[model samples]
Target: MSKSLNTLFAALLLSSAGNVLAASSVDLTVKGLITPSACEPTLSNGGVVDIGKISAKDLNADQETHLPSQYLQLGVTCDAATLMALEATDNREGSNFADDMAHFGLGLTNDSEKLGGMELRIVDPIADGVSPWIIGLQNGSSTWIRSYYFARDNILSVANTGGAIPIPVQQFTSSLRINPIIAPTSGLTLNNEVAIDGSVTLTVIYL
Candidate 1:
């Protein structure tokens, strides 16, 4: 199941089966856990990747244009050694050219045309001064796999080389490489300057 930092509130109704017709009330219970240790995640350069001005005539007319890849450092620090995970949420959703989870939207043009897409990859993760294997649990899967690419609404964690579960760590750092692709210019509205607007939020989750 997918994990989240939000407190889970579940209400359990209790009633006697024999008194199904006579019972007038039932007991309700709500349960959740709150951890003491908190984690803070930060990105270098204020998490901004500024791709300078691009000329419309310089873009490909019939094919996608792959821009130069950019790298950003992501750091996560915890008050104590805590089991945690990172989740990425795209602020510009539904604007990508593809429907794949690995692709993040770059925003739209003319209010209807998709601008393009971008892919985020996590590389060389170091946890507590030790290099650990980056792991991610696939949606609907119970097992964790060795993967560094960020997926939509997926939790990314770190573990030992042979471990299957996330390990506790007070500090974690990694490089987030961004690969951006622009759609064909022939189909885009280039009459005015179209900024490449892509925003994603990285959240830390206590596991």
Candidate 2:
């Protein structure tokens, strides 16, 4: 073959190889922009109460009996969109031990423009010596009570009440509703923001 023809052929092969290499090579660039909104009305502090430690003697006997009430009101804050829900569990592994005894209701008020017509509810209350009382008051009225029973073989039986109410071999449940405004005379005005906080009082009459 002629040298000129060989040079032309070599140039064509080199160009084809370059094209194949270019096709095999991959180059990519990815870009993204994200913006997040700031959080509002940062969560304020609150409080909690453990019913197990509360003794029956601390009630009417002590002048400072109100201590439990104070502890109950510690960190309670309710919003119109997000209501509070409370749960009480009595898990005693002994042969004859009653569950916790307690009563609860809601207290509400709206004094800010950011919220109005507040409402609360009693989600659950595991009372002792009686059935489980799960009911909410319209405006913190008509306290719901329940008797605690002993757990035997993972089953709870209501304690005997001198022929008052029969003991059930299972757990009980109850519910209640809380309305911020019960009377027509009660109207809320939230100029900036509404805040609701209160304490729960539990009066236990031990057997």
Candidate 3:
């Protein structure tokens, strides 16, 4: 996540107002890079996985309960070989009450209680023969580094040093390991049935 990668892209804002300068001739141009390649990301289950139903008895009274680790295939396919990365945006922001950036919350209870959170990780990334690197641009700051292991805080970059990497192939694959947990029974105000709701949105960011 060096500045080379962090500053790879930026948005330009143009503002025009202030009486329009008495209708004088003014030229405002718009520019952007439009690449021939496009990429899309998807989950094997159409982004849904059912964990069945959990009874209060299933949770430990003294500690949080980790339901189980579910593994799903995450893939990104491009129209052609393209330099790209996958960006994940947490849909349920700030709901988890957890301090881990890679983990997000499960929404609220009837009493406005924080249910818990879930964590996502990328395991065993596979592209043609190149090893892609996971990057966290440090909150889009000027200093950052690439990560081989991914958390919610990082971006899955092509690991191109200074510029973009024309992928060797049009497809990339990886395992998305989902770990959802229930808060400790003692810490929650769960006197009745509650539903666990967690979500995330992923997009392919072409560099």
Candidate 4:
């Protein structure tokens, strides 16, 4: 089972990693509880990167297609700074350039064909003063602690890390850089159409 903030309308490329068959269709679902903390998170461009029209012939058969780096901003603003930690839930898990959990799966290539993987990196963290009080178990309250960009602790995960100690600030901002990799086209069967369906959800935990 995988996760998605929203179902991916299209996949980057559609082809079998090998000969694995794809399902006719898959369902997408999200579950969470809303709170009164008054905090909201947003992504620039709805978190989609337009690589434009890429011709299969232009793609390399021996090497994977590593697109030019795409960028997006992830920010959170609150009516009143609250204590919370953010985590990333992979809608399509275990699908990556490698078996890297930091990277997310790109879903099936097409008709059961397998696609490639992508990763989200945290950079340039800017929180209000007195913010980032370090996020820990809810049982124990935390104090203010700030982390610079690319801190391993800031790598969003279901557990500790990606989140920091909750600081009492109304706004928290950061740069979310996405690295998407397209597997080589040599082995894949090119059809008339292909899709790039990758979805991920960034959720906050009130600690």
Q: Which candidate leads the pack in TM-score? A: 1
Predicted structure with the largest lDDT when compared to the true one: 1
Q: List candidate 2 segments past 4 Å from native.
A: 1-186
lDDT of each: 0.88, 0.28, 0.71, 0.60
Clashes of 1: 0
What local lDDT does model 1 show for residue 86?
A: 92
* Cα error, candidate 3, residue 167 (Å): 6.1
Cα lDDT tens digits, model 3, 1-207, are 676654554321123433355444789999889898777888997889788788888787777789898888988888888767677777877768565776777887777777788877777777755556555453555544655444566666654444333344577888888888877777677788888888888888776
Task: Looking at model 1, report the run of 10 residues with the lowest lDDT sum.
Answer: 5-14
What are the models' TM-scores? Answer: 0.84, 0.21, 0.74, 0.61
Which residue pairs collide in model 3, if any?
Answer: 1-145, 96-105
For candidate 4, give the lDDT of residue 46. 87
Residue-by-residue lDDT tens digits, candidate 4, 1-207: 134422342232334345677658888999887666777888999877776666778667888777676788988788876756676667776555455545676676565555676777666656773233233232232433343322212432112235543445567777787777777776555675577767788776564
Root-mean-square deviation of every model: 7.0, 24.1, 9.9, 16.7
- Tens digit of per-residue lDDT, candidate 1, span 1-207: 233322232212233434456446789999888999999999999999999998988889899999999999999999999999999899999988877899899999875788899999998889999999999987788889888989895789999987779999999998999999898987788888888999999999887
- TM-score order, best first, reads 1, 3, 4, 2
Mark the regions of model 4 whose C-alpha exceeds 4 Å error after superposition: 1-36, 129-166
Q: What tens-digit string does per-residue lDDT give for candidate 2 at 1-207?
A: 699999999997987984565445577999764323211111112323223343333333212122322211112222221212233222211111111132222223343211112122333333332433332222233432332221111111122433323232222223332232111212323233223232332221111
How much does candidate 2 score in TM-score?
Answer: 0.21
